[model samples]
Target: MVRAAARLPLFFLAASLVAGFLLRAPRSQRVDSEAARQSPRARTAVAATGELVKSLRIGGTIGTLRSAAIRAPELRGSHVVGWAVLTLVRLADAGSSVEAGDVVAEFELKRLEDHIADLQSYVTQAQASLRKRRSEIRILQGAWQHEALRARAESAKAVLGLPTAEVLSAIEAEILRMAAAVARARGKRQAEVERLRALVIAADLGYFDVWIRKELLHIERHSRDYKRLRMKTPIGGMVIRETIFNRSGEYAQVKAGDRINSGALFMRIADTSQMVVRAMVNQVDARTIRVGNRAVVQLDAYPGLRFSGHVAEMAALASPRRGTRSAGRMFIRQIPVRILIEDKDKRVLPGLSASVDVIVSMGQRGVLIPREALQHETGQQAGTFVRVAEGGEYRKRHIAVQGLSDTEALIRSGLAPGEQVLLKGLPRDQRR
Candidate 1:
């Protein structure tokens, strides 16, 4: 049932075509006696005198060729309690004029501020700990030095006692000599241990200083992050909100209270000093439009106004028309083209819906012929011809065609102005 409901529009379109099919008048009949026909080509029209201009109609929107984009604040690497995102507190209204240094967006800084405070406190504690450790290392150094000096002093005293060995018994002399050697050995060992202990203390102090420095750096980075909560525009321009995909998979403009990922495009400051009409030409008519072709643009918002421009650039590639998934699936392609407006108007604004007519050829009082009167035969000798009504019969005349559009042809030769041309019903000799 859902499938059938979805196809109802198609069924309605088919029904409308069937209902309107009878209203359209068929073209000329065939030649010969039996080809006497249905709907004879009796719809005759006289060639009129006028300027005939041929052009291609393309639909597009008014926009600038280039624009400056305002991006969201980069807060990606600052990890605290996980992957942190800034809360949007303020957003500039779309279309509002903003200047340099104007705050476009502001994020909630309370969290970052609190984190900064925590880092500062940690740094203070780390510095204090580093200072206390350094003091303790100094005290240990003094104690170790004194112990080493006292051991050396005892060894000297033992050496002095050894001088008495010559005047004393042999056993006493040997004991004095051994005591002095033992004191010297103990002093050397104590000095070696003190050197090792000093090395440990130096390493500990270096680590302590490094830890404190890291804490201070972290604090500085957090303070910078807190300052980054406010985003500013580099130049003054009218604000244009940038569209981003929401969690629901739909694109929407970034606004206040919206949590956006780091580095996401948040807004645009359009360079409106120069405006261009960006149009898409269908592939069938794309080749006719080229760079340097003249175009006239009409804004849908202001129906009475028109602006002239020239094709500044055209896309090197074609793509399925954007904004429609069905177009991609159906393989319908359109070439993008830009026309720079020559005359600037204050009322003209970006994003306005506009219709652009790219002039193919401008006819200057050329003879115009109705499209139905011309026959486009397909062959080597295939020429564009028109049936002329002369003296109770129609005669086929091959003519030099200047340009032909969808509805009319601008004739360079052959047909004269005010000449009556046979249409729809044709003479049997002229009909196929």
Candidate 2:
């Protein structure tokens, strides 16, 4: 259930609603007419004894003090082009407790997986092609080596014939000289063959490298896209899906069938152990609320339950509260305050509406009575007057009420302990 927290400070404007010193209102008693028939008024009660404290209630939401927001896996720093849209296939339900490294949301990964499979297959094919190219180069190198050896042998034979040319006839000597020149030229062709051999080696390596680069790039893209498909909570806590405003001006939770933009806030994981209430105090009352002030936390869902806490942090700056615009001007400036919950309870959850009452003064023992016994004059809510049974006749006794509570009121003066007073109906304004 979502609700606004702007009306909390207004709930407790006068007396402190904090439950530090509990009120013990004395029970109303029935008076006998035999004692007094002159002033037959209403029921009477003796003043009881209890302690009273002054506090102020500030409205806020109960949340984990050390919470971390879990967003959609962001690939902004990565080299992905254009808006990345993903289909949500699996997601953890809201309010479920999760452990560290748990899967919070899973997107449609079949497409990514299929692309990765293709890239892997290409890598395999590239490996095979590299091996095949190496084998072919080996065969070609062997042929070149045989040609060079044959050329060297022919050159050696030609030189042998030249050494005996001087003893041969003129025609035989000329033919032998021409044969030696041709053999020497043929031997010199080995250098060109070696150049061709180097070219072939380079060509084969270059062909394999072209495919290798393509294979690595595809593999990199596949790995990066695959990791972005699944998202996880970094710490152990509860999961809360964030509500995103779409281009159509509609706010909705990121769910299945919803396409999320790149770098959009998706989900949040909160630390449940250290819970606190975040409240906004008016600029005037903000000064009274300081860090380390003891307070009482109350939840709307669980009535009659009070949790103890203390102010943990105070905002260094004040700003206008959101959604408080009216007549083209700012409404009120509020200071954000954080109160740390001292005790743990099952009902305490993130985003739950709660209120914190700051204790301003320590409790002191005083004469206490039920708030019903005090009667207020018309148009006045304070300065309750009581009908005290004194001098054998019931009369009005104006008493000074120092502190008040839901069911009790502390008399600072005028009303004494063990004194009898007439009890009225009930107060018009309720404390809580």
Candidate 3:
């Protein structure tokens, strides 16, 4: 009877546990279903019509049209060895207005007197030598004529039988000797005349005249060494730079000698009335930005102010380097571009840093969306999913996109305008 009672209690306990387990299973499933229904839905919007877009922005500098450094003229003047500049008489200062034929500076002339005096002495000596040569030639000619007359008289006497054979022979010998002397003197006279003519020409032209002119212009165009200086503005505007000795006793030091060769840059003048911002672009990008394209320039020095400009020119060839980040490297595929400022003020200076925006294209209509929305599937086949509301549940539809920019892309055939797309977050089941 004890065994039977124990078995009865055990059976009753097993039945109660089975009933409790079955009851809790249904409740758990119901709770899970309700939580899923309460899950937050992602909001979306349709790709809409917009204007055409461009990319590839860069910064550059605004520089003058030209700039030069003024220097001394190279004309041959009295080179005062070991004589430093005593003073600088500056006729023009930096930024000063100048006209053609204006004197810029003057040098001290005391050192040149000696050279001039030496040239004068050379002229006098040449003249005196020429006069002495002429007198000697005249004396030799007279002696030759007398000897010829005596020879002729003696030959006649021989023919008339009034002179001996020896006398005739003596006269003939004297005539031959005198003839040789006359020829020699005539030759010397011709040589002296040629020499005097050359000297006269030299004196008329002036000593070192051609050389001085060439050297002077060369120095004006190229070198920065001179004692006296004059600068006539080649182009009328402003003297962008002037290196004049300011102190009354100070002198600008130059190279020891006065000769300067070609291609030397002495002084530079520029027209500052207009300014242009020059920027370099990859050769590929440069092709897209043609001359006459409109651009917007922003100066880093002036915040919130934008300047308008247009593409003035493009480089015909690439720079000597390649790649964008290589500073000063030869660009194998990059070209320089110039942008002309529409309105320039005094604030614009050469080498001012500025940024540019080139408009490659524009439009008022295209289906576009943020670039992040696209998802790659396989090979060239890429797509994105659009959320469709069906029976209070979200369903994903795959769509195609095209025409990508840095920030946005065009939805070529994926979804139509006005259809909503999920942008904030993806559904749990649709997460990548």
Q: Considering every candidate listed, which one attains the maximal lDDT?
A: 1
Alpha-carbon RMSD, each predicted model: 14.5, 17.1, 18.1
The residue-by-residue lDDT of candidate 2 on 166-201, one tens digit each, is 899999999999999999988777877798779878
Query: How many pairs in model 2 have backbone atoms within 3 A of each other, for residues 3 or more apart or on separate chains, i.e. clashes?
Result: 3
lDDT of 1 by residue, 1-432 (tens): 999999999999999898777554242222343465553556688988777778887888889876777666666355645425556779889989888788888888777778778878888888889888888888878988898889889988987787688898988888888999998898789878988997898799888888878878777766776677887887777789888776567788877777777767788877666799988888889988889998888899899698989999999989887766773465878888999988878777898999887888876778888777888676887888888888867778888888776557788989998988877766555566
Residue 267 local lDDT, model 1: 83
- Candidate 3 residue-wise lDDT, 162-212, digit = tens: 334346677775665555555556555655755775576456445445444
Please say which candidate is ahead in TM-score: 2 or 3: 2
Q: What is the TM-score of each candidate against the true structure?
A: 0.66, 0.66, 0.46
Q: Rate the local accuracy (lDDT) of all candidates.
A: 0.80, 0.78, 0.60
Q: Arrange candidates by lDDT, highest first: which order?
A: 1, 2, 3
User: What is the alpha-carbon lDDT of model 3 when measured against the actual structure?
Assistant: 0.60
Residue 357 displacement in candidate 2 (angstroms)? 1.0
Report the Cα lDDT for candidate 1. Answer: 0.80
Q: Between candidates 1 and 3, name the one with more favorable TM-score.
A: 1
